[model samples]
Target: MPRILAVDVYQVAMPLKYPWRTAYGEDHTIETILLRLETSEGIGWGESSPLPQPHYVEQWSAAAFLCLQQCLVPAVLGRSFGSPEELQQAMAFVKGNTFAKAALDLAWWDAAARAQQKPLYQLLGGTREQVPVGADFGVMDHPEELLPLVEEAVAQGFPRVKLKFRPGWDLPVVQAVRQRFPELVLHIDCNAGYTLRDAELFEQLDRFRLAMFEQPLGYDDLWEHAQLQRRVQTPVCLDESVRSLHLARQALALGSCRWINIKPGRVGGLTVAREVLQLAAEHGVPCWVGGMLESALGARHCVALGTLPGMDYPADIFPSDRFYEEDLGDPPLVLDRDTSGRPVACPLEAPGTGTEPRPDLLRRWTVNHFHAHA
Candidate 1:
């Protein structure tokens, strides 16, 4: 039996020079909750909580982390890595606290993969070696800011760019970027900024030839999205609202959206994420993995899941170097660049999620700390 050695939570802040605006919300900094799980044999890492943004899942908070430290960790200690299903069931008692449960569930998977000396993706039965990636750019103050940003991202080798869209800014921003980079793959994420009244505006968006329009209506309003899907030519993709496999099924059954964005933390963990992906595949609804500015630990998990067979769309899994000043992993997650200047692969060569924390970087960015049992 493997005894749990420790569980530590750290809060880190990454400041963005300019405000990152999106239809769902805006922010000047990214607040991250980093979780480290250690056993007598090895260590595993995970991240829960969004970047203190309103639109993303708000289920995680500092108080929730405290709850994890006090209650969840103790329950998980001394557990064996019998199987993913067994570990998942063992943690099922911590229901109604998905974020906290996600942190623990992800860590357990990481540890199990390490114990077997296998990559996380291998454990998940995915092996395409690579998945297409796209950049999710922040909304700029001026539409003029987009050309240069698009050019810069293109120059840096991003295959596609998804711009943040708000009401007044949506058409102009897409048109400007399209005019400059007519051949580039361009998509839009409304973050649920539009209402039924704005459904006609999507016709205007059709002129720009967007790849997709994401979450144009309220997060929870699957019925509204289904109506919008009927009215619009551009395929609709749901983000925040599809929290569980059941919600995903509801959205698919109603024809709410043609695409779904799977963020593991929001869905509970990779366990639920897999279920969502399986559901999407069964229904023939396309899906892609979404990002939340995660550290290497969390990003690796996304990469592992994104490598599945039906994940045909470009994922938002950019390399850790793009956001982190210093990474948790020694070899840091590398984006395998191709001669065409696009990232072709994200390798998971190391065991587990293939990430280990840098103590020095952890010390500099972590502002708060807490410990839980086991």
Candidate 2:
């Protein structure tokens, strides 16, 4: 039996090239808490990168890390990873701290896959070697400003492009991007920008033949989204509203959303994420993996989940080169391109997530930390 020896948490801040804005808030930097779990014999890592604003979901704070260090880790110190199901069940006793719970869950999955010498995706029932990748661009001041960004992303070979939408900027942005890149796959993410009263705007947006209209109303407004869906021709995709498999089912049952953006941290873990996928499949709605501007640790997990059979839609997992100045692994998560210049999936042949953290980069960005049970 393997005994948990130590748990370490580090706060690392990475700068973004441009400020990222959404209906929730805006940020020029990404601050994340990385979880390091060590057994008597080996180590596994995970990330808890909460969005900067509490609008979508609550932001991850240093206090959260303190809670994990003092409360969560102690409870699991001597626990055994006998089975994923059993491990997850043991975690149920420590509920309400979803972000902290997600870090532990992700580390447990990583440890389990490492113990089995398999990739995380295979452990989660992924069938494909690679999946299509897309880029979710942020909102700009003007629609014309997006043309160059779209052109650059196209040159880098993204199969699909998703634009951020706010009330005043929604229509013109979509129309301009659609007109310029007529054949490019286009999607819009409102980030819960509209309300039931904005039905007229949603009607106008239907003319663009969007790939999907994401989170058009309040994050928790399932009935409102269902109402919006009824009024608009564009298919609806839910992001912020999906906090768990139960919420996902509710949204699906209410006919509020046709697709879901599965973010492992946001939903809980890959274990629960798989449950959401199974639920989506049973209900006949397709799902896609969404990115949270993750470092390689989180990104690798996203790529792994995207390889699931029913997740045949284009993913937001672009190549590591697009976001990171320095990545967290060897043979960094590379984005492969097809003959037609669209981003294709590259399977991980190595064990687990197939990458290791770059200690040098960690040293440069990590601000404060102390080892517990070291």
lDDT of 2 by residue, 1-374 (tens): 55678888777776666688877678776776678878765777777666554666654646557667777777787777665556557667765455666777777777767877888788877888778988777877776677998999888878789988886667878888888888888899988878999899889888889989988898767999998889888999998788778898899899998989998877777878888999999999999988777777778878888988778579877566676677654557777777787777666876677766688877887766757783
> Which portions of model 2 miss their true places by more than 4 Å?
94-96, 329-331
**Least well predicted 10-residue stretch by lDDT in candidate 2:** 52-61
Each model's TM-score? 0.91, 0.92
* Overall local distance difference test of candidate 1: 0.77
lDDT of each: 0.77, 0.78
Clash number for every model? 0, 0
